[model samples]
Target chain A: MAASMLKVAVGSRAYSSGIRDVLWKLGRLNHVAIAVPEMEKARSFYRDVLGAQVSEPVALAEHGVLTVFVELGNTKLELLEPLGPESPIRGFLQKHRDGGMHHICIEVDHLPDAIQQLRQRQIRTLSPEARIGAHGKPVIFLHPKDCGGVLVELEEA
Target chain B: MAASMLKVAVGSRAYSSGIRDVLWKLGRLNHVAIAVPEMEKARSFYRDVLGAQVSEPVALAEHGVLTVFVELGNTKLELLEPLGPESPIRGFLQKHRDGGMHHICIEVDHLPDAIQQLRQRQIRTLSPEARIGAHGKPVIFLHPKDCGGVLVELEEA
Candidate 1:
């Protein structure tokens, strides 16, 4: 939001390359991620009140979070709860006990080209490489600071 | 993620009604709202880096924010900047100076019936009535606390 107040780095040679030719194709918004301290409570709120169909929770040990997909007609909502002491969700819940929106996932057509474009533009990515996401698709996270304080996940469509 | 870890609330008499017959039909996600401090910089980032076509910033004085739409193939991103000190975006930026995701707008076929259902379920809505939003459509904001800490907007599609 404070992008104008931000110090812009001088345009790099890569960015000077034809911007039209490198335009990446963005796809549908696959899902929005929400971090909750108590997973069941969040799920119940969606299921009982909103009448959304939620999938069974699955633990991704590598990511250190339990995840569930609340299916809606257009897109899905991913609910996350810390699975281990060092889980990042634990840190987030420590600040916001009630939980909060964590990230938004947007699908892209080509993962490799997208990553290459981001790298050339010098955007900060959370992982050096794309990891297999909950959807079993290649996904990479961009740093929140780099993304106007909103963590963004780009999933291969 | 931990849908299984939740304790199910026992059904109340209010829930015994044939509410299932009146299920609200949710449509495609209309847009996701982001609160940014500087509109131009945020626009440039999306336009140049993400290759998104952002619309001209439009001031919504009644809403106390300047809004712009970043057109994606599947969904749109609404960027908001506070218009004055009294603006809610100013308050959100007080806590998160860098700006952040403000809310998500989902479309519903029937907003009045949806609001009635939410009222029946005792869900907290930001306004007692629906207001005309940026798209010139009736929209209502649901309280974040009642929505698992994620501010939600239901727009009549």
Candidate 2:
């Protein structure tokens, strides 16, 4: 019985250690934001067709855009459209030639600390300072050219 | 004084409602997985260069691939490489032309119920049945064609 117990203990230890290593590598997923020409049409596909729950639309006057949030399993899909001329979404649509993935936002525990770390490493940031996001959270954009063409957003949740 | 008091009460209500809406949109992020050609090269960029914490590589023999998890701010970046001849990542790499975003995984409260809901809606899934994922959690994959060319994974944690 003792020998059998020892064997079980060793097997369990091996499994747990492997899992721990994987967990160490994983962080949390932020929000996936998609740029669209029309917010209502995008919502129809994401909400009606895909069965994602829609949150009330928010209009950010300062940013010159309107956004609708779709609550997925455990993440939020943000659909953004330009409110008028000179909106960022308008520029994105013109550059990409179609509505697609715009950027990936990642939540950080500390906004200042994260920004400092990135700055120290000579990473280029799109915004010099954090700005108020759609949800009123402080957020900053990282230049895609520096991150292998992947636009990244660091947010304080 | 009575009129002023009434105005303050109404203002407070509006403020509270706005705050509630923002909090509701801030959901828990699960993980973002990226398809790469070589796991070692991905690790060098994400881990050594980006200073992201990493986990030991794990080989999923059945899936014909190896995966390494990298911890970012509040989310994990999963790097995948094809292992055997039957691996799907190889095809994904070829189609994409370079390592880019692969699939976004969202955590759900229930796996069976979500799968049933998707099935009833005539949505096609990669796997007919849910399988255990890296963390011993049930996970199912949704076909990209059904979701507008975006492959999604629903994980029960």
Candidate 3:
């Protein structure tokens, strides 16, 4: 299981640099994922209330969380809820004291190059390698400690 | 001056949808702005430490704040500092009790259409009209109270 996970992770990070290059070319913003304590309540606002198109919530078993994607033009609003006690979303909720903005994800063309650059700079990453994110995009997270407490995600579009 | 500012605001909102649509064509995840009490300290982390290409900090006279933009791939990490006693960042800090994620900006294709759709659904918004944001982007804010206390920013990329 661990080896399979590792393979998936390596494959995801491999596109880091490609993602960076694409972002440079697009010159536009992407999506932002915010952590919410209750997924249903979040959907009420972003989907039902705001009228943003909603995508089915996906369960990320490895992360112990469930995420709902809200489509807005080219970008997306991702609402995350912890599915288990040990999930990081639980700690984020306690620290934030309420639902708040979680992390900023930038769509890149190459995930591996971005990962390599980040590693060269000694930045800490949450994942040992990139993994497939929701919607089949490759993604990796930079640790908040290395990012001044703001979780940064790099995604391959 | 207030009248002029108001006029600019009106004109900006008018073009919001056009810009948003353009951004939508480009891609996902645009930028994430974080508010901090100290600008230089935040700069050290995102710029020198993280190796993100940094832009010179700029002060917005109207908003009474200083902002620094860090370029990472195609997205930006914006760090903000309250410029004066009346700056809103100070209030956000007081209410949140810590320096953390401030707002998540999601790119959209049409601001007016989205806003109208949101209004039709009775979602609360911070402004009835879109406002000129950093980099001359037209943006509107969805009230946190309406989104489970998570302030959501809708922007035209």
Highest-lDDT candidate: 1
Q: lDDT by residue for model 2 over A4-34, one digit each (tens)? A: 1111122222211111112113234567887
Task: Identify the leading candidate in terms of TM-score.
Answer: 1
Candidate 2 per-residue lDDT over residues B135-154, each given as its tens digit: 67888888865665467787
lDDT of 1 by residue, A40-137 (tens): 88877777666666666789988899997776567777899999877877888888878888999988889889888887777889988999988789
TM-score of chain B of 2: 0.78
Return the TM-score for each candidate structure: 0.84, 0.66, 0.66
> What lDDT tens digits, residue by residue, belong to model 3 across residues A1-157?
0111111122113211111222122223456777888887776565444434555567887777898766655556678888887887888789766677887776656678767766766787887989887656788898876665667787776
Runs off by more than 4 Å, candidate 2: A1-30, A36-38, A41-53, A61-64, A72-75, A85-87, A90-100, A109-113, A127-130, B1-29, B44-52, B72-75, B95-98, B109-113, B127-138
Tell me the TM-score of model 3: 0.66
lDDT for predicted candidate 1 compared with the true structure = 0.78
Where is the poorest 10-residue window by lDDT in model 2 chain A?
Answer: A1-10
**C-alpha lDDT (0 to 100) for residue A115 of candidate 3:** 75
DockQ of 2: 0.12
For each candidate, how many residue pairs have backbone atoms clashing (under 3 Å)?
7, 5, 24
